[model samples]
Target: MANELTEYQQNLVSLVQSHELGDIIKPLIKEIHLFDSYISGTSHLKDRSVLEKIAVGDMLSLQREDNKFDSNAILILNEDGKKLGYVPEKDNIIFARLLDAGKLLKAKISSITQKGSFIQVGVGIYLVDL
Candidate 1:
């Protein structure tokens, strides 16, 4: 099979290749949510004080849990390896399977929000070039 780049990937490549010296280019991969933390049951138990300190671009770690209700459950962690929450059920299966299949997926803190009783933490998953 021939390899192909998605439209989005092609655009990013063009943007990068056309850059001149001193050009200020933003990250090629913008922040995207692989999961929503607000809907997670353990999200509330996280230390808001700590979560608030998490900033964009901060690297995150994912841990696979086989015993969780969702067999594909993936736990998200902070830099210090503290459990922040989990990858929401909606997107957990695919992500977990990818990890299990030996894919090198990197995650980062994309955005964090606190509104009323909801604490939303969005993670950005980066697909590394093989």
Candidate 2:
């Protein structure tokens, strides 16, 4: 592939509002110093040519809360702002890992009678199984 997005990158692109690409990618593309890093292509080499450049790109119009997890994994909450599930390191989003591995892949609703719902998260993948 001349340029391919990783599963996580793909999920990110998927999450992006196609109507507004700049608004979506500018925020979560991952930043380092002033230059923001995006998965230009799926090639893992750290080269600038194939890499998309944004030394000073537009920041997120909406401020996204920065939560740093030392483990590099993070739990994504549901719509109600409740813990739903986690995304592993390297941003691997596989159905097998989320479903077959018996991982802490799914978060349960705290109360049976609650109107809230569970969110499914695996890296960039957000599957609404519940």
Candidate 3:
């Protein structure tokens, strides 16, 4: 048969060709987990030089803990399983909910700053397609 396509297939092809998929499916920055001075495990980061190498999109792992003082506490860890800090209480509510709902959420180190007494690391929460 001569090259042919159904009406639906032709429409889909035209749509794909006409639109930039990147523009349509951009990753959303849902929450920014800013490290607070009171967050546990941060003291260890003071002597650590790894923070300097952390990049914008470096993947961070989150572990939800129900027994923690903050019921919504989510432990943030680096790739090597080193505990970075906890997602700030203010931002953990929705993050915990999303995790409970089994959404494929990924956390990344968005920014890092070394201030007077504490090192501030901002974790960006994103809903990704795996």
In model 3, residue pairs whose N, Cα or C atoms come closer than 3 Å (at least 3 residues apart or on different chains), thus clashing, are none
lDDT of 1 by residue, 73-99 (tens): 877777788777777788777776656
Q: lDDT tens digits, residues 28-72, model 2? A: 543222211122112323332321221222121110122464223
Q: What is the C-alpha lDDT of each candidate?
A: 0.61, 0.30, 0.60
> Distance from true position, residue 7, model 3, in Å?
42
Residue 83 lDDT (model 2): 33
Candidates in order, TM-scores: namely 0.61, 0.21, 0.58
Candidate 2: pairs in clash: 87-123
Model 3: which ten-residue window has the lowest total lDDT?
5-14
- lDDT value, candidate 1, whole model: 0.61
Q: Of the candidates numbered 2 and 3, which has the greater lDDT value?
A: 3
Number of backbone collisions per candidate: 0, 1, 0
TM-score top scorer: 1
- Per-residue alpha-carbon lDDT of model 3 for 26-98, expressed as tens digits? 4431334433222345756654665555676788777777654788787777788766777778767776765
Model 2 weakest 10-residue run by lDDT: 55-64
